[model samples]
Target: MPDLSTTYMGLRLKNPLIAGSSGLTGTRAGLLELQEGGVAAVVLKSIFEEEIAAEYDDALSEAARKGMSLESYDYYDYELRGAHVSQYVDFIREAKTAVSIPVIASVNCTYSHEWASFAKDIEAAGADGLELNMFFLPSDITRSSDEREKVYLQIVDRVLKQVRIPVALKISSSFSTLAQMIDRLSKTGIAALVLFNRFYSIDFDIEKMTVTGAGSLSSPAELAGPLRWVALMSRRVGCDLAASTGVHDGAGLIKMLLAGAKAVQASSAFYRNGAGSAGVMLKELSAWMDRHGFKAIADFRGNLSQAESVDPGVYERVQYMKHYAG
Candidate 1:
């Protein structure tokens, strides 16, 4: 059998497939299932600063609606925030004790002076690594793209300085010069970059004039967004590339590896096919590799990249002259 073992984010994984951060990976049982199912590594569910803050906001509003005393409101607000962070701390500890696989704790942050302290504490709590999910919302008209880019770089430097473990950034594809951003971010001494964390979108029920949350899952077609960039920048970037979103099967994993991805992270697929799907996926990949006579992942890794492929323009070309001809 070919060597499926590979290094990702400076950590060795049994294979190239990782269980991405999602609800399915939030518990000890789920983590064990995924690891047993053939995931090389697993990124725990992200602990969002904003989500923790929202608990406070919701408490305050509920207190007001109930006509509560100011004293009670203050007590609830303080208690909620502490409980949130403390729960995350406990989760990290339990998860570390539960599994031998690399447990990467995730944080969804914008720019927080508090994150440095949080990163230090998370590392202390037994997390093997940190995955920071960050992006500047385009809805902020006051901030220029350059300014937003500065925030991301600063965040990277701050957290990296605070943590001893390897750090990987889960970023949004919201930059004006994405190629430049990847190049600069890679130089920041991080271990890896997870392409494009999918943002949560909202939908409006126009009939009822109400707003609702969009579905959390990503479709298989969604992989194209991250796939293209992975192929283009994989060879040029400084650190390892991990493809995220829309990876549902063995074929998708093969495509990512060929595009120079060190590994692929999957989330939505487990929800669609259950945790055991990873086992099935690994078998399929091995079968395909055997049939193709490729002994290892490196044999054809990045074979489709612009720098490595015969038809370089196919990866970079946006317009076909055939379609534009008059």
Candidate 2:
């Protein structure tokens, strides 16, 4: 058998398949399942910053309505936030005890604030790594790209100052200067970068005349965008790159490694195919490696990246000129 072991974000993975954060990874049972199914690591379901803030606001309003004193209000506020943080910290501790694989705690945030301080609690709870699932929609037309990009840097700086474990930033490919933004972020003392987060999209309910969320699961067809970017940026960036958002099977996993991803993260695959999907994907990866006479992941990883490819322009080509002409 070909050696499937690889290192990602400075941690050794038995294989390159990671169980991405989702409902499936939010519980101790789910973490155990993924480990049994053969994933190398697991990114715990993200604790949302908005959810914590909203709960705090609601609690304070109820306290005020009850005529709580000002000092009591302050105490209530601290306790409310701590309650939320403590649950997540406790989850991390439980996951560490439940699984032998690396447990990566995820936090979804849009700004540099008190929530960033939760990184300290997470690190203290025995999380092996932290993934900041950071993004804010660029809907505000008045905000300059620089101004918007500054928030990402601020959040990263704040979180990095609070933790000793490796930090990974999972961001959407929404920046105006996408490559430049990625390059800048890769140098920010992060251990890895997960390319292209899949955000919830709005869909119109034609008959109801209301908005609803589109399907959250990613199709295999969704793999191209991140594959292109990983191939293009893998060699250029200072930190390791992990591919996410569209990897559903072994072929997709292989493409990412060939494009230089340190590892690949998948959530939809497990949701659609059960925890065994990770094992199947790894089986395919090992078989492919054996067929190619490769003994380890590094032997051919990045063999097809833009920096190494003979037809590098294929990645940069935005139009199907030849096909259309034919």
Candidate 3:
């Protein structure tokens, strides 16, 4: 039998299949189904800073339209941030109480300051770990890359100081020097790193002249991006890597692990295939492993990473020109 179990961020997952934070992970019943589906662990849906602000804005607009009195509006517009966070913390407590596997709490942050102490609060609520989804938009053309990068480091510092629980960072592929950035981030006492957060893009309808959000799931071809990066950086970075995006099946999951990922976080596949899809993917991987004569994930994991490979140039940009020219 293949020993599919692997460790990530100090947590012993039954397999390296983490159900990433999404609508699928928001409910207790949903989380139970995922655990039952043979996943290693689950990252709860992120508590978004933008969402809290947006909700307050919607409520204020409604109240203003009704002409509410100034004295009646005594509280701050976004005071519900902690209240919502507390609710999520309660959810974690419940998840911890309900399951024997690891349960990670996620936070989607816009900046690197103040309320970062909330991470410690997550640990207190019985969360086994934390995944910081740092959202740094490159909207300010005037901002130097140094400034943008510093924010990430600052976030790591603040959160580390705030929480004793293991921390992992989920970042987008927007950095100018991604390899350097990953190396730097790994030095910050983090337990693991997830590749490429999927930001919801805005789409405009020409007929209505209005902007709307894009769909939640990733297209099949989309898997290539994270697959490529994981293969390239598998042996390069200091911390363990988890592949996210474009992973919709067992083949994709096996591909990610073969590329040296500690785990694969998926969303769209679950959305399309329903709750038990994760189980199907695991079964697929297990069957493939048996046929291939690999007895365990560790037997092949990181075989292609820069850390263990014979030709490191294969994962470096130095060979890209040759491939392009050929």
Candidate 4:
């Protein structure tokens, strides 16, 4: 059998498929299921920065209404925040004990605030690694790209100082200078970078004249953007790269590996299919490897990246001029 094992962020993985951070990885039961389903690792459901702040504010407001003492206010603040952080820490401990594969704790943050310090707790809780799902939507008309990009650096810097374990940054490809940003971040001492986080899309409810959420799950068609960037930047970046979004099966996984991704993260596939979908993809990958006479992941990984491709321009080509003109 081909050696399917690979390493990401300095941690060894039995295969390249990772259970991306989602509700499916929020509990011990879910972690065990994914392990049994044949995933090499699991990124625990992210602890949202905004959610913690919002909940803290609500609790403080209720305390004010009750005319609590200043000391009581402090108590409530510590207890509320601790409850959230402690629960996540406890989950990390439980996940580490419950599954043999790596447990990567995720933090979804928009700012470089006190929450970045929580990474230490996550690390102390026995997490194999940490993934910062950091993004700041470029929606503020007054804010320049440089300013927004600085926050991402600040968050990574803060968290890096707080823990010794390897860290991975999961970011969106929304930056104006996408390639430059990827290169800059890769030099930040991070172990890996996960390309393209899937943000919640909004859709119009024409009948109700209100906005609603678009499909939260990614479709297979969504893989091309990350694939192109991974192929373009993998050889150039300082750290390893993992492909995210649009990966739904073995073919998608294979495409990413060829594009030079060290690993592939998937969530929608499991939601649309089942947890066992990972095992199915692995089986397909192994069969394809056997037929190709490849004995290990390293034998073929990055074989088609732009740096190694015969027609490197194909990856950089934006227009379909050749196809249309031909």
Best by TM-score: 2
Across 10-65, the per-residue lDDT of candidate 1 in tens digits comes to: 89888899999988779999999888787988999989888877777888999999
RMSD of each: 3.3, 1.3, 3.2, 1.5
Candidate 1, position 240, lDDT? 94
> Model 1, stretches more than 4 Å misplaced?
56-82, 320-326
Candidate 1's TM-score: 0.90
Model 2 spans with C-alpha error above 4 angstroms: 67-73, 322-325
Clashing pairs in 2: none
Alpha-carbon lDDT, every model: 0.87, 0.93, 0.85, 0.93
| Local accuracy of candidate 4 as per-residue lDDT tens digits, 228-288 | 9999998899999999999999999999999999999999999999899999999999999
Cα lDDT of model 2 by residue, 1-326, tens digit: 99999999899999999999999999989999999999999999999988888888888889889998889877876898799899999999999999999999999995577888889999999999999999899999999999999999999999999999999999999999999999999999999999989999999999999999999999999999999999999889999999998899999999999999999999999999999989999999999998999999999999989999888778888876988457
lDDT of 1: 0.87
- Which of 2 and 3 is the better model by lDDT? 2
Better of 1 and 2 by lDDT: 2
For all predicted structures, in order, the TM-scores are 0.90, 0.97, 0.89, 0.96
Model 2: worst 10 consecutive residues (lDDT sum): 317-326
The true-versus-predicted C-alpha distance at residue 299 of model 4, in Å, is 0.8
Model 4: which residue pairs collide? none
Worst 10 residues of 4 by lDDT: 317-326
